[model samples]
Target: MNGLSRLPRLYVDPTLVPTAQKGAPCLLTPEQARYLGTVLRKKVGEQVRVFHAGMGEWLASIAEIRKDRGGLVLERPLRAPQPCPPLPLAFALLKRDATDLVLRMGTELGVSEFLPLVTERTNTHRINPERLHAIAVEAAEQCERLDIPTIAQVQTLPALLGNWPHQTSLFAAIERLDKRENTLHLPTRQVQEGDGLLIGPEGGLSDNECQTLLKRPFVVPVSLGSLVLRADTAVVAGLALLGNGLRSAPVSSQ
Candidate 1:
């Protein structure tokens, strides 16, 4: 039973298993079934962990496996569902590969929601939500996360700022700040749970876009240091700094 933890974990839809208990049948998607049977060569009675964002995780054994379909029998519960507050990371959409990287790494860093923004300089306003969602799911599984992040539909920069909730602080990473504007440097204090981090696309936000963000009371401009970083790099660095703050702060404060 201890070795069951080492088995591959798959994210199952919560709706697929409304009730979970020992010996309950858990169906697998065609892709998951094929991956287990063909790729991993796992046979009936072999163990695997199945999880869901709202239903928690369970250790189960392969009940049956064929070319395109399979099922599992739950052995026991591994963890109970415990959802966290939104860890929103709103970033300008970059190239396909960069955007995928941001979603993957962002999931690993505990981001619970992703808001893709289209700014004046953003290369494109389009994205395949299905593909991006899969990337985040894989990252969550690899990182042993209990939940997957939700990828919001693409939205414009001004629209996001205008509609953002007033209670949540959005840390905007602004580059090339003047010495007198040093107050805009990243804050040293711990960030609250609902707080979010925003990253601009490569070439950074335009002058007009920057001014718009500055005017928003919810937007707090922060410097990611003097050296200019690639868009994807900035997302990772900013999240790391903010995540550190969240981890260090007292639980009651968060």
Candidate 2:
């Protein structure tokens, strides 16, 4: 365990990772095998940290490394299991690269769930769930997050608002509102545990969409200042603004 802190970390599916007890052998995915063997040149007996949402993180020693498969022997626990907070981020679906950036950065920024909204001005409604989940897992692995963020299926703006929970307020960033008609400021208040942030598409939500959002009691209209930002950029900026309100403290690893 002396050098375990320096080992590469991998996010493993709980169902596939087996038990968490010491000396238990855990199986690795083919991609992980390639990554450890070919990519990182990891060999037998080298230690690594494997973690997941429900199982927390464990130190393990590489049992074997082959071209298409690998296994690790569990050594001990590093961090206790903790679920991600319900700080959901609802953003209008953008192009491929931008959407990927949103997923990666949003995960790094402590977003627990991603709500992809299809607004009136959205260019596309399709999302590759598998690809996005992979990006999130990779980002979580790099960011040292204990849990991965969940990505919701693509839905319309109205649909998202309809299914939204009543207890949590949804902070929506809608720019250039008539000062007379709009009174809500950006991040009106600090974000609570279950509160969320919503960013519109590149061109911003349509007039009708803005009206629809403003009408909702749970939706808090927000302004991101004078400068308009790209959809991806807005996601980062909006999360940064609202992060201060989060009540959960960061989990320290031993």
TM-score of each: 0.94, 0.92
Candidate 2 residues 1-254, lDDT tens each?
A: 46655789999888777688899889999999999999999999988999988779988899989999999999999999987777899999999999999999999999999999888889898999999999999999998888999999989887898899988899988888645265544335556778999999989888888888888888887778888788899898889878865744454479
The residue pairs that clash in candidate 2, if any, are none
Clashes of each: 0, 0
Cα lDDT for residue 121, candidate 1? 91
TM-score of 2: 0.92
Cα lDDT tens digits for candidate 1, 1-254: 47765899999877667578888888999999999999999999999998887768899899999999999998898889866567899999999999999999999998989999999899888999999999998998888788989999999987888778999899989887655343545444458898999999999998777777777777788778999999999999999988887888787733
Model 2, backbone clash pairs (residues 3+ apart or across chains), number: 0
In model 1, the clashing pairs are none
Off by over 4 Å in 2: 1-3, 178-189, 247-254
